[model samples]
Target chain A: MASNDLLKGMLKPIILKLLLENGKMYGYEITQLVKEISGGEIELTFGALYPILHKLEVEGIVKTESEVINNRNRIYYSITQKGNSKAKEKIAEFEEMVKTLKVFFKPNFGLKYEFIG
Target chain B: MNSLDSKHIRLIEADVENARITINNLSQELVDHICCEVENLMSSGKSFEEAYTIIKEQAGIKVLQQIQENTLYLIDKKYKTMKSTMKITGNVSLALIAIGTALKIFHYPGASIALLLGFVTLCFVFFPAAIYLNYTYKKDQKKPMLNLSILIGGIAFMIGVLFKLMHWPGASLLLFVGWSIILGIFLPILLFFKLKEAETGKERSIYVLGVIGLITFEVSTMFKVFHWPGAGPLMILGGVLLIAVFLPLFASMKFKKGTFTMPQFIFLITTSMYAVVLTFLLAMNVSDVVMDRFVRDEANSTKIANYFKNKKTVAANDSTIKVSTELAERTDNIAKLIFDTKIYLITNVEGVSESVAMKYVSDPDLINNKSNYDIINHLLEGENNAGLINSLKKELNEFKDKAISVSTDPALTKSIQELLNTSDKQMGIGGATWEELNFRNTMIISAMAQLSEIEKNVRLVATIVK
Candidate 1:
């Protein structure tokens, strides 16, 4: 599991990307999907996820729909057209960041290959 | 795949409720998430209770609350900041008002500064923030715009009242605009919507009656601020509606439903409300009684009128009143100056028309008469007259021993100077409102007494030509 501070910065793009791909998802479903996809490496806490999702909703990047399932109301959030473009831009920027950071960890570095990006 | 049973889902719902997740959407989301996590754990061969416990332990209750807090913060940073700022300013304004009232009561200085700061902060910071937050928060709820306007009108009306109390410029305009919005738009819409949502016709009518009372009261207050007609009648009508009509309706409702857990609680509330209404009535009566008695006992009105008439008669007898020198000429202007000062006190401070106030002096023709003891008598009965007296004293100090050495009585001038000094201490600390009435009355009386004493030692210092 990633530390909360590190995960906090990463969660926004991760959520936008998830909604972009999944069409629509509720709070728990998104957390479960992340756990499954990351093979338990990135366990998204409800504490961390909901706020970003809510912020996204407030920004008009995502909109919610309430549906009754198993006699319980589930609020599902879907990415808007704005969110789709935003997600793409964020992913590209993150990749660029990673590529630049990767250059600093060239062979013959102090750290082992296992910890390298 | 494992899914929670109805019983387990119900338990999750109860847990969300226990967490005080009052926001419907957020609470629903929490329950779903908790159920999903419990089910996933249960699929791993744990019992239902064990699975729930394990998931609960993993995601602490504190974490659940943190999510709610973070969501609130994230949705609007300005809302959070404004909310806190509003609270701070609201408290500060209230404190300042309390302290200001106390200062005025004790006849201390800085009362106006405190009051001005309080009102300005309330109007600029607190009201704006409250209006913004109420609008944004209620946007998702019913009648968001109406709620916004209601808050704006209510707050604007309160600000106008403060402005009036401070006797600030544009008080009339502000009050007019505020009352128009509240009475013409907000009140009607509020009544219509509240009645529309009424559970029973009786309840509907009761609330309507209450609303009518409130509207009448507000209208009367607005009228009172502007010094318009029918203010007293309208105010009484509003008071009757609230106390006689609304209170009884409320009691009947409470009794019919048996909603009161403690009988004494309802009784106490009703009694307290009655006390408040009675207090208002008593206060108004007391103010009138005090003002009448004070003015009559002092007889400043009669004295001032007599003095004005005597001056007029004396001036008529001698077309060109002779004085010894230039100093005597300057000294002669003092009487007219005091008369002008009296006129200013009557028109501005008392908020009475110049013509009407002139009637208070028995002689209409003496309105432009030269100053005398009677003129000072009436002039000193005003709160702002203290300021005029102080300025006059200052001007006298500049003239002391320079051009008029023999004409003025030293002992009388010194006493007048002392009185003016004491009056200056009471300056800007009292106003004409019910709350400040006692302080203001005392200040005016003290100044009047001093002016009367000064009037006794009449000195027309005729300068001896070299």
Candidate 2:
């Protein structure tokens, strides 16, 4: 599970990337998805989440829609065109960073043979 | 299962609610993350109470405190920004006031509009903004600055109303009274609070001095309105108080804080300049009125002279023959002199000539003058010429009677009578011509010249005549 600090920094990009892939999600649904993806090891906080959503709304990167579902009202957010493009760029950058980190952890061929025996 | 242990569930609910409200200051996403973590823990083997407490502990008190502190910091930052904006607005308002005052002094067409805009900016926009900013600053501290601003604004409005009521030239008294009222009324009030908050004796003394000075000035102005003998000196003293005492005190106050505002400078400049200009104009207008009265008297004398000359020529010739070349030439010369004198009089008078002329002619000595030649010479001699024309008419009538009695030649007697009658008729026509041609021309030319001078001085069209 990612630490709260790590998650705080990555939250916006992760949310953007998720919205870009899944198209739209409500507040409760987004929290549920993050928990499920992290195998119940990670969580999102409502206090931190709503302000970001509001800020994104103000910045025109995200837009909200309200609908009545199963007798309860919910607000859903979707990535704008600009947000979508930014999401793709950030995901690519994150992937590249992960790829570079893999090289340091990979074992040498000789050391691997000795350890295996 | 003992109804799912309602007490335990209730305790968990209370904790969750407390966390939600307090954590709301943090980002919505963080709260959502904490909520999801607690929900997941509850879904696992842990009870709801255990899950909530565990997640809350893991989140740590330091993170929540940081979030709270960050929110407070942002609020403070926003407040500071608003304060700067208010200060800037106040400066702009004062600038507009200065520009409006300049425009009005120069008599620009849109000066009234400029003044109205300036007042609106000061009273409605900038002052309120300043008060709001001060309110925000003292939200958790002292409360004097906001109250002071409001008091100053009210005093300013009253001064504005007085300005309109008095309609005094140059707006000097208005500005002085306005500034004084603000300083006098608000200084003590602000000082009272300031002393309570800061316990500074220096600030209190400065405020006390300001109030004393302003009250003295205000009382003096009221005395002036009552036409008291000591009013002028009192006004001067008040002006000195403002410049020497209050202004320096305000400056020192600003220096202590290492901050200076443009409004303070503007108020100083505006008040002093208004004093100088108003004093100058008042002195100028009074002298002009006195000088104009003297010039108009001279013009009336010239008019009387011209009147007598026309009468003399008419009484002499009647209708028999055109006034002899000698008399015509003499009359023309007198007429010309009278014409020149009238022009000189009108030029000197500038404005209020007609009233002055009317006042001049009302004297019996001037009104009795009827003969053109006698009146001209009498005016030239600087003596009474009022009855000259009437005397000349009587003299000419007596001469006609003597000619009728002594002449043996009937034809000669008849021709002389005819000449006398023609002269009288021609005199009427000639006098009318002189008035229309010479006097009217002098008036028109002098009026235009005076208008040009006013335009040059005030940058405005003189609406005095036209």
Show where candidate 2 strays beyond 4 Å: A1-117, B1-92, B139-149, B152-185, B194-207, B217-232, B235-466
lDDT of each: 0.64, 0.50
Model 2: CAPRI class? incorrect
TM-score of chain A of 1: 0.83
Per-model chain B TM-scores are 0.50, 0.35
Best by TM-score: 1
DockQ score of the complex predicted as candidate 1: 0.56
In model 1 chain B, the worst 10-residue window by lDDT is: B312-321
Interface RMSD of 2: 7.2
lDDT of 2 by residue, B1-466 (tens): 1122345444434333333233232333344445556556767677766876787665543444444444333435565566576677778767877787666444355655666666676777666666665454333235555366445646464445435522434344555555555555555566566566443677767666665666566656555443355555565566667667776786778556433446756777688668745743443443444355458556544544443333322222333223233333433443343344443343233222555544433321122111123323332224353332333334445444544443345554554454333142234544542122212323222322332322221111010011
Question: Please, what are the lDDT tens digits per residue for candidate 1 over residues B1-466?
Answer: 6877788899778666645554448878988888888878888899998988888776555566667767877887876798799899999999998897677544467877888888778878887777776666533256765766767676777777676655566766777888888888887887888788666989898888988988888787766545566676787788788887887786677556433335545675678587647645643653454456577546544443443333322221121233334445555555455555545654543344777656633332222221122333444444664556555554444433432233234443343333222223343665343213312333232333333333332232222222
Error of 2 at B302 (Å): 30
TM-scores (chain A) of the candidates: 0.83, 0.75
In candidate 1, residue B10 scores what lDDT? 92
